[model samples]
Target: MEHPARTLTARLLASRSLPRTDPQVRRALVDEAFRAELEARLAAVGLQLIDNPYAEHVAVALADDVHEPVFGAGREYAASNIGLTRDQIALLVIIWALIVLPKRERQVNRQKLIDDGQHDMFGQEAPLPHGEEVAGSLSEASLLADFAPVLGHKTYVQGKLLSRLAQLGFIERRGGLIFEGPLLDVLLDYRLLADRIIHGTLGEVLAQAGHPLPDSDGADEGL
Candidate 1:
């Protein structure tokens, strides 16, 4: 919501201001005020704020298709762990979609694996990643564990919800595991990559090459 307003504001900024006679300025002001009010309302609860405008400095490892944040690190963000606002929740969704989900996709598929199913680079020690059903508890998925800190939800709850999302057409799942394809698509469609971008140890190298930040969602940093 806030992003939409700001996007609208940016578009509005592109054109000249006509505050002297144009009534459109009022609408923009009203939108900003509404967002502020909404933020205030959310703050009335226990949710704190963190600026993710550019969601800079990748906090988690991700795939190549995911893009980095443009306004991160320097921008002001509003977030809350307890009483989240619609915008705050939306931002979380956007971050995972844009940043986390894409990176997850790149980590698991394609030519990286050998024809016999061994990893080309890792040669089978690629975490041998699998999900152990996650039926009785939420202890199976590490990605859920990784996300719990940022989203401020119980690991169990987050895993359960992700499982549920996977169950529906919203995403895909198998072997008690959830892949990044469908999930990343949803996040991208939702324009979510504006959250944290977890970089790998080779962050400098990737940044110089203008590539997506390296992350540890798959093997530990290296291929």
Candidate 2:
């Protein structure tokens, strides 16, 4: 008979080498013996190996010692609050740029004129004030351009993504323009959560564009 240690090692090696597409391999991957060993090993490092076959990918997280009630529900509620898919988050960031950048530019110009003591350019003693309404509308063309780097090459996919976001109440499309919806208000209410979600969703884009992400300091960087 093979040595007990050698037998366990062989089983682990065989399980790791198995292809996930094969039924037998899938079963072996989640075998009770293998999971027991995995859990024991993970526990040594204060982690847990949860089996979530329904998830598209595995997730790693810090283990919590507290067993408080309603904790799971609270987590679910937070997820629901920021329920936009990854693609939708990316699209929303682009829309925000289109809506905010122009207003920011105008505000800078108005401040400059006021500093120069030339505030009567429009026959008024004060400069025209910038308002939120002016920065909340975006044309379809601009949005398409903003989305080009990520989703532009695939027009069908882009259209579907935009339609999905609209259907989810994240954006409103009217004529050839898009406007912020109630969902955006919810995101803004939780600014930190929104930032973290955007950071994770746009990580690849930021890397490709040679942009740096803000430093993480005990913030949720998405799942």
Candidate 3:
């Protein structure tokens, strides 16, 4: 059988992302030496691991030093290599905010509860929640009703834009509901984007939709 660390690396390269529940992924999450080995191997090729304790998946991305040379070779820097339009990017952000922000808050709260020694005796050492336990799905109809005006091109938002996001593993759509895909949390840095979305122009837009976010100050440090 292949070595576990090598297999993990190969899987990440091939699949782009893997759920935390995968055996290799679980090993990487809890085994420091194994994780370091994996990280070093990836870093050799100018890639870095993208892992967050609160996120349900792990992925790899270009190291910062490689970003400019790789994407900005000739033309102006592109927002995404996949060729998403400005509006498409905007819609992506909106969906991310609607789904991930609240999910993060729940994860943070659960962590706090665990830290406060509030867990049941039998579950005292339970791991942090992942997947749908910490994340929640959104209603497609509710999304259209709430964000269509802000996003415009309702047909495109409901069709091509959504399909594109799904293809890229940012979201999953099924039977009029939307769920977070593997890359949704791992791809975006919550620490950096959360504060901006909570306090900036997007915060105002979200407020208009009757979904005002909590003040960033309310979250625990490093959250």
Q: Which candidate model has the greater lDDT, 1 or 2?
A: 2
Across 1-223, the per-residue lDDT of candidate 1 in tens digits comes to 3454344334333431122122433343346775564344334432212221111111111222222242245324335223335434543343343334344444344324533466455555433222222111122254445445554576544455554454432334556554432223322322323223334333443344343443434422232
Say which candidate scores most in TM-score: 3
Compose the digit string of candidate 3's lDDT tens values, residues 1-223. 7788888888899999988899889998889999999999999989999987777888998898998778877655577766787777887888888888888778778767776778855444777766657778889888888887767767978877888899999999998999999888888888788889988999998898888776666554443
- lDDT against the true structure, per candidate, is 0.36, 0.47, 0.83
TM-score of each model, in listed order: 0.26, 0.37, 0.91
The TM-score-based order of candidates, best leading, equals: 3, 2, 1
lDDT of 1 at 5: 39
RMSD of 2: 21.3
Please rank every candidate by lDDT, starting with the best: 3, 2, 1
lDDT by residue (167-197, candidate 2, tens digit) is 7655678988887653443333223433553
Which candidate comes out best when scored by lDDT? 3
Candidate 2 vs candidate 3: which has greater lDDT?
3
